[model samples]
Target: MKALVLAGGSGTRLRPITHTSAKQLVPVANKPVLFYGLESIAAAGIREVGIVVGHSAEEIQSAVGAGDAFGLDTTYIRQEAPLGLAHAVLVSRDFLQDEDFVMYLGDNFIVGGITGLVDEFRRARPDAGILLTRVADPSAFGVAELGTTGRVCRLEEKPEQPRSDLALVGVYLFSPAVHRAVRAIKPSQRGELEITHALQWLIDEGYEVRSTVIDGYWKDTGNVSDMLEVNRTVLESLEPAVRGSVDTASQIIGRVRIEEGARVTGSRIVGPAIVGAGTVITHSYVGPYTSIAAGCRLLDSEIEYSIVLSGSAIQGVRRVEASLIGRNVDVTPAPAVPAAHRLVLGDHSKVQISA
Candidate 1:
């Protein structure tokens, strides 16, 4: 079996960050989000892989060159546009050949990995298999309806009136038969050939479609909130270690991993956090669920439940929480300016001036 991972898209939700970097490359716990998916794929025993890439193809390739580090022989396939999920499959047809493959969304995070799901698919040999999870907002996802026998009966993409709360997770398994399904399906109203539509096509053609509702944690880390949530979730299982230097003035509490070359002085870092290699934290409060990336400097700053990317510096900032700071950013006190009061008052507006 092979794997097809989709790492291409205009990540509008992540804005300025995505404008400069690939969304999949965004770090969770000081590691690229896509790296976890690649590790999971390698764990699933899929050797040959094809990565679908678009505008950020070069960056993806640079980071995942040859994929040997992840134990997969990867081949890059170009998708000129971010058409849709099924369109990715269509473009990767040559690399996928007639082999059964798993389509893993690069930016999606599935906590327990896909080994079990792949094994189940191998046993069942369904024409197509989809992973589903119960979500609070079904309308935000491609919702699915199941039959009495647990087969996928129907699906609707972002329906105004959802029939079920089971939303589609980003992992999917498909046999060569899906190639025909993708070809037979038409583009949706959104002008893209959605994978949901392709699966619906398979169901209409009398092919067996399987569905599994996973209870494990899963997320599409395309937005800031989800990214931070995933970071916290991953950090929960952290192991305490201090390979770096921590001065006597510093206090490190539970489950903190201080990477080599990192230094902490006069700082109190509390549990479930990571200080990446070469990062220095001084006279600051490094709170729980925070990941400070490599080569960063945090001086007299209090940070918690946040991710600070590489080469970034936060100095003299009182507090930072639940933030996704990008690479090479500098967070410092803004230069002071003369105080003034300029107001456009409403009917009952009250103003007070300081002498």
Candidate 2:
């Protein structure tokens, strides 16, 4: 079986950040979110892979060349526009051929990988197997309804009133039988061919559809909050390693990894944090769940539960928390200025000032 990784969605929720960069390329623990999906696919023993990219296709192509970096043979398919998930599969038909394949969303993070699911799919060979997880807000995701025999009976994408909380995780396993299902379905009211609709078509037909309810951690890192959460989750598993220089005045607390060339001095860094290569942390407080990317500088500031991208600097800032600072950003305190209370006084207007 091959793999079709969808890396093309326009991440509207990520706003100004997505305006400059692809959401899938956002770093979680200093690693691109898309890389995790690619690595998971590679681990699942799927060597031949096709990545459907749009908007930031060049960047994606450059980052993942022949897929040799991930030990897989990759082909990049360009989608002129991100119409929908089903549309991606439609465009990638040539690359996918008549083989069974796994479709993975690049920005989604699923802990424990998909190796077990892939093994199960290869054994049973269902027409389509979707990974599901119970979510608090099912309305935000594609939800599935289970039948009497524990099979998927119905699927809905972002329903107003969901029948179940079983959300469709971003990983899908499909055989060549889905080709006909895609052709049989019409575009939804949104003018895009949703993958949920394609799966519903298979249900309408006499095809076997399966579902696996994942108990492990899974997150669709679409918005900034989720991205930060995933970063924190990944950082929690890091082992303490100091390849860089830590001055005697510096105090490095638990489970922190200081990459080579990074320097820490006169500062205190709490656990489950990472200081990337060439990053400098001086006279600052690097709190837990913070990731300082390569070539960054943190001086006289306090940061926690945040991700500072490569080449960024947090200098003289009082505090920053739960933030996703982009690359090359300089976050410094504004110059001090004299403060005064000024008011435009009109006739019969009274103003009180405390000296």
Best by lDDT: 1
Q: What local lDDT score does residue 144 receive in model 1, on the 0 to 100 scale?
A: 100
Each model's total of backbone clashes: 0, 0
How well does each candidate superpose onto the true structure, as a TM-score?
Answer: 0.96, 0.96
lDDT by residue (tens digit), candidate 1, 225-284: 999999999999987899999999999999999999999999999979999999989999
Model 2 worst lDDT window (10 residues)? 335-344
Off by over 4 Å in 2: 341-355
Which residue pairs collide, candidate 1?
none
Cα lDDT of model 2 by residue, 102-201, tens digit? 9999999999999999999999999999999999999999999999999899999899999999999999999999999888788888888899999999
